[model samples]
Target: MQPVINYLNTNSGEIINSLGQHLTISFIAAIIAILIAVPLAIILINHRKIGELVLQITSVIQTIPSLAILGLLIPLVGIGTIPAIIALVLYALMPVFANTYAGLTNIDPLLMEAADAFGVSWRFKLFKIQIPLALPMILTGIRQAVVMIIGTATLAALIGGGGLGTYILLGIQTNNNNALIVGAVLAAALALIASGLIRLLAKVPLKYLTFAIIGIFTLAGIGWGVKSLEFQQQETITIAGKMGGEPEILINMYKDIIENDQPQIKVKLKPNFGGTSFLFKGLQSQKIDVYPEFTGTVLQSLVKTDKAIPHRPRLAYQQAQKLLQSQYKMTYLAPMQYQNGYAVVVRRSTAAKYHLHTIADLTQFPALKAAFDPDFYQQSDGYPGLKKFYHLHFQNVKTMEPALRYEALAKGKVAVTDGYTTDPQIKKYKLVVLNDSRSFFPPYQGAPLVRTEFARSHPQIIKSLNKLQGQITTKQMQTMNYQVTVQHKKASQVAHQFLQQHGFLVQKSSKR
Candidate 1:
């Protein structure tokens, strides 16, 4: 509890910023959904067939997984707030539309008849009688949509839409319960507050209620437009990174170096941005200016190769650099010395019990359950290649999130899992990394990946980034990850210390 308090105290500014972004995204999505759904639903109340068809379509959209929706939207609309809001609006539509249609249709038939018999205009029948009576149900739907949108907005962080989801993802990846608690608690609180506001809005007079809604929407639009314009006027370079403490630290290092070397250029750090594929897509679409990439991942996942990649780090780096330039027109800069390659890890006790010393030893324990992250489960150089080369298969294999895999292994939920060489959990969990006797996995040296056009336009940025070449070692990376993950140190602080120690930045003088 105290640690959580400390985290909150230290990160209040960021928490507030994230909260603002979360509210902006959620509010925009909910308003758009209400605007589209309620009027359409009311009109369709008189046309049952079209109403049913539209409701069915919305229901189907709600059934698709949020992550899948985001993935699909990436290629079409690109990443950031736009796609996130679009996906949220789609998810929010069904509840509001269905509720509005049902409310209007289910209004007292006698009351609607009374309005008709009195010779009231059609507009009076709708605005005065049917709509006034149906207000409760409509408000109920709005409440539901607002709450749902707030919850789902967390996923926006995965695609560079800034929100509280940043803290949530970081916590999960680094095993920081304090960060996790903060994000979850704040998100729930936001939902409750929004729900309460909707309830209050339900009690207002109809005319003023309409005026209030319009005023709120107009104010929000103006504020957001001003903010967006201000942001666009600034020169910013967005640097993103994959999930994990190492990538977070590396990106912070990159940010510090580039800022120190070129003070005029503002660098925006989007740490734990997403997986390899998401980041790659962002780069291709020019949504991100730069990000860290592994040489082997480029060869195995991004570039097409009929032949096997060599195990040597230099050869793998050369091949990746050449192929990326020729194929994608992306520049792969000089790599760090550390090779954060794949490792087959097991608990110390499990290794002893099964006499597991190498990848081949796993064949003897086919019954042992294994847990793997989604990427490794699907990537060619990951599980598939390992299984084919070792002739080993676990009968009960679970596809787990990257952070959860280590916890599962530690708790004896599974006996084996794939890990990176520089993962802090390797030391924390006292796990054994089985040797790759057959050399099935390729070397994965980390480097800065940038678009060729960006590289050409900003050669100074490239010069500052190249200072990281051959700088970090595997042991040093492991230590830095441990500091961030275990000691609860900030990645930026750790990165700053490393840079100062390595003469990249001048050390600060001690104050009396």
Candidate 2:
């Protein structure tokens, strides 16, 4: 409880910023949805035949996953707020459109006959009579749309659309329970608030309803126009990264470097964009200019070559780099000093008790129980390769979150766990990384991957980034991760401190 409170207190400003962003995106999406849906509903009410086909199409759009919609739009809209809002509008359409058509078409026939007898204009009847009676139903639809949009807006964060989802994704990556709960609670609160506000609006006199709706659109238009102008004026260089502490650090490092050295370029940090697949897609599609990636991830998981490569780091890196350059027109910068490869770790106490110092030594303890992350547990290059190479099999194996594996080991629930070589938990829990004497695991040296076209356009930026090569040691990365996960520092702050201590920022400042 105290942790939650402290986290909120410290991040209150960011929380407010995220809340504002969330509200803006939802409001814009809902307003746009209303504009399209209400008119379409009126058309459908008049022509029942075509309306059925239109509704079917909208229903199909609604069924598409929100995340998938964002992905499909990335090539067309190029990510960020535009694609996010477009996806939300599509999701918000079905409820409001259906309700509007139903409300207008289901009006009492006797009332329409009376209006017809009086020779009232159809337009006047729609504005004065039919719409007035259908206000509640339409408002109800609006309320539903607003609520759903607010909830769905969180997915916007996956595409670098800032909102509460930013905190939620960060929390998941860093294993911060407090941050995760805060984001979830705030998003729900926003949805409830939106629903409540729209319900209250339902009570407004029909005379002013049009005026109110018009005012809402007018204001949203002005805000969106201003935001669009801002986006257009800036030259943005988007830096994407996969989930986890290391990626966050590297992205922040790239962001800080570009922003500080070249103030003219807008550095957009798109954190928590899933794993290698998403990053690769972004690079290939020209949605992201740069991203931090691991060498082994490209070689084994992405490239999918079954032929055995040397267990050597340089050989593996060269092969992966060549493949990416040839196939995707992407370039890998010089590798960092650290290797963040998979390692089999055990508590120092257990290591001492069992005299386990290497992968071969583990074969003697066939009774040992182990835990692995789901991806590592199933990868052909993971347990299968390790087992075949080392001729060892654990008595029992469990799949669990990478963060929880340390706790499981601490509680003696598992004798061994799969861990990253540079994980901060390794140091915090006093875990011993067993040597892969037979070299079953491939090297995973850290590096930044950039699209060749982007690199060609920004030679200075590329040069500035190259200065980071071979700067961060494995211990240095572990300490930075510890600062973020254990001490709860922002990844950006840790990255800035690393840059300052290593004279990266100093060089930038000296130029000024």
Tens-place lDDT per residue, model 1, 312-412, is 88998999999999999999999999989999999999999889999999998999999998989988788998899899889999899888899999999
lDDT for 503 (candidate 1): 95
Give one clash count per candidate, in the order shown: 0, 0
Task: List residue ranges in candidate 1 displaced over 4 A.
Answer: 113-120, 345-417, 430-440, 506-512
lDDT of 2 by residue, 44-74 (tens): 7879988888888889998899888988997
Tell me the TM-score of each prediction against the true structure: 0.87, 0.91
Candidate 2: stretches off by over 4 Å? 12-14, 49-87, 158-162, 228-234, 304-309, 507-512
Candidate 2 lDDT: 0.84
Residue 32 miss distance in model 1 (angstroms): 0.8
TM-score of model number 1: 0.87
The true-versus-predicted C-alpha distance at residue 419 of model 2, in Å, is 1.3
